[model samples]
Target: MPPASHDGDRDDDDGGSFIDMESFYASSGVSFVMVLLTIASVLYINPYWRRVWFYYVRITITSCYYFVVDHLPVPVKYKVLELRV
Candidate 1:
């Protein structure tokens, strides 16, 4: 076999040099949901708005024993995307 390139040699066993995850991965199923929630939270909160509290209202909302079923619209999602680097 031919020699691997520098980048090729440094890749993970799966062959990704820097795995650009479409989403987070966790071992436990519940833990997996936590990862998804974290990513979702990052994508939901607006930056210019500046969070009102130390913790996001959504995270606290659950602690409040309230469950909101409806999803926010596209424009609201953009609010979070704007927070990106």
Candidate 2:
């Protein structure tokens, strides 16, 4: 995309400075997945997806699954993963 203006250099925002938007939900989804994966791999006695001393597809799949489901609006079931209000 072209710059917003042509003053001296190019301005990112037509108004003047940059406009930063908060992405809470998307960031929450990522954090949720990461947290669950770490907890599952490191804490659980017999984790649903851990049986090794190294990372593998098991970790990948579980993390991805948690990440995807973490974004769904499934009430407390998934909302509990939220790190923010």
Candidate 3:
């Protein structure tokens, strides 16, 4: 008697599946390396950008503080300023 065939099993004559996935794998690998290089270059070259970013952050915080305090009553504003110091 002949053996029964399974639906999920691969046929011996079929081409390998890796051929279909090769381009997808290669593209993803290249994009991953590019992203890594971009991050490393940013961190290693002209790190002064970090200082500039910090300055902008400080200015933003100061502006937000002023915006909040500008609306408060004078007495509360003074108390808040005193607490900050």
Candidate 4:
């Protein structure tokens, strides 16, 4: 590709950088297929890994919730508890 003109105006000679979606998708189809296959394998091929992943996600969320609650000011914590009661 020729160097861009010093001025901001585009030269008529250049076809411009328009993307052809059909060609782009054709080229990228293999990557898309690979990704889908990977996702399907992880979700269906190995049930044990799926269970472990969910378990870790649940534990991570629960721990973060506890950490936030535990770090609250004592007075605020007491107020929250009183409100709950």
Tell me, by TM-score, which candidate is best. Answer: 4
Model 3, which residues run further than 4 Å from truth?
1-45, 73-85
State each model's CA lDDT, in order: 0.58, 0.68, 0.77, 0.80
What does candidate 3 score on TM? Answer: 0.34
Worst 10-residue stretch by lDDT in candidate 1?
A: 65-74
TM-scores of the candidates are 0.23, 0.26, 0.34, 0.43
Residue-level lDDT tens digits of model 1 in 1-85: 9997666565447545375443234346668789989866775786534455435776788766543334424465456545556
1-85, model 2: which lDDT tens digit per residue?
Answer: 9779747776555454353334556788899999999877574666544555336767888999999988867867645574786
Between prediction 1 and prediction 3, which has the larger TM-score? 3
Candidate 4 on 1-85: residue-level lDDT in tens?
Answer: 9988676575553445477666788879988999989977887878998898789989999999999989866665457444553
lDDT pick, better of 1 and 2: 2
Model 1 residue runs over 4 Å out of place are 1-27, 46-85
Task: Report the Cα lDDT for candidate 3.
Answer: 0.77
Best by lDDT: 4
Superposed model 2: Cα runs more than 4 Å off: 1-22, 44-85
Worst 10 residues of 4 by lDDT: 76-85
Candidate 3 on 14-53: residue-level lDDT in tens? 3546455667889999999999998667857767986776
Candidate 1 achieves a global lDDT of 0.58
lDDT winner between candidates 3 and 4: 4
Residue 82 lDDT, candidate 4, scale 0-100? 42
Candidate 2 lDDT at 34 equals: 99
